[model samples]
Target: MNNSFGLTHIVQFFLFVALQVLLMDNLVLYSTGFCFIYVAFLLYLPLTINRVWLLILGFIVGFTVDIFYDTMGIHAAASVLLAFLRPHVLNLLTPRDGYDSSDAVNIHVMGTRWFLTYAFTLILFHHTAVFFLETINSQTFLYTLVKVLISTLFTGIVVIIMQLLFFSPKRERIDYR
Candidate 1:
């Protein structure tokens, strides 16, 4: 990728964070479902990004979100967790031939099935950690679990929609760190 494409990732990172704070934060359904769309930024990053940089980026995303939500570092924790687990999840879902450096993780490139599996797994875990961390009280476990599941389903669908709507095929590979 060219330097401009790398810069695009940074721009997208800010866009995602801004979208989450300014819009998605107010979009809750029946007080349960939520769209944590900022992580979409992480999901679409270059597959070859260094692990440490990925982790740091994740922390930055989470910290920015935490600042907006005023919920301390819950979002940061979940974002870091998602980043830390992303490589493992990629490994688990890798095709027998493995990923090409140019392989982009989007519905346009990876197809609906692979993309759905990838997004679902990561979002599920992220939501679980966020909800659980927010409420450690065992008595509210069922409510929290429902929120986690519902929010996961909601966010997954929105993320998919966002992918279908915004993620067009690239003429060339996009890389950033």
Candidate 2:
């Protein structure tokens, strides 16, 4: 990536973290759950980005969030895991040689069904890892499962909305060749 692209990514990363810490973290829907729209940063990274850089970026983003939430390293661990798994997940959803770096994974690029599946799978992975580590001692599988589901749903919705509202593709058809 060029310097401009790197700078843009960094700025977006901070904005996502700020949104997560300042806005989403405070908007509790229930007693013990809240949305985390910040994960969208990892989701929207260019498909062609280096895996190592992605993982590093994930750790930085998660650690920043951890600093804000005072939750130790849970977010960092989960974010790194999500970043590592992203390429695999995208590969599974997209055909060989069909990936498009210019496009963000969304309903417009991947179609609704694929986008929904992709988003939910990644969100669930992130939430599961986060809540599992958060509730390490209790081992309440059912409660953790519920939390993961609810939080993933809320976060996924917010991610989709933000992508639709703020992020726009260049409107050129990707040449899969």
Predicted model with the maximum TM-score: 1
Off by over 4 Å in 1: 170-177
RMSD of 2: 2.8
Q: What is the Cα-based TM-score of model 1?
A: 0.94
Best by lDDT: 1
What TM-score against the true fold does each predicted structure earn?
A: 0.94, 0.89
Error of 1 at 82 (Å): 0.1
lDDT of 2 by residue, 1-177 (tens): 577667767888889899998888789778456687778888877777789999998999989999989999999999998998988988888856686556655567767687777888988999999999998857688888888888988888887887677655554333222
TM-score of structure candidate 2? 0.89
* Pairs of residues clashing in candidate 2: none
Q: What's the alpha carbon RMSD for model 1? A: 1.8
Error of 2 at 42 (Å): 0.5
User: Relative to the true structure, how large is the alpha-carbon lDDT of every model?
Assistant: 0.89, 0.81
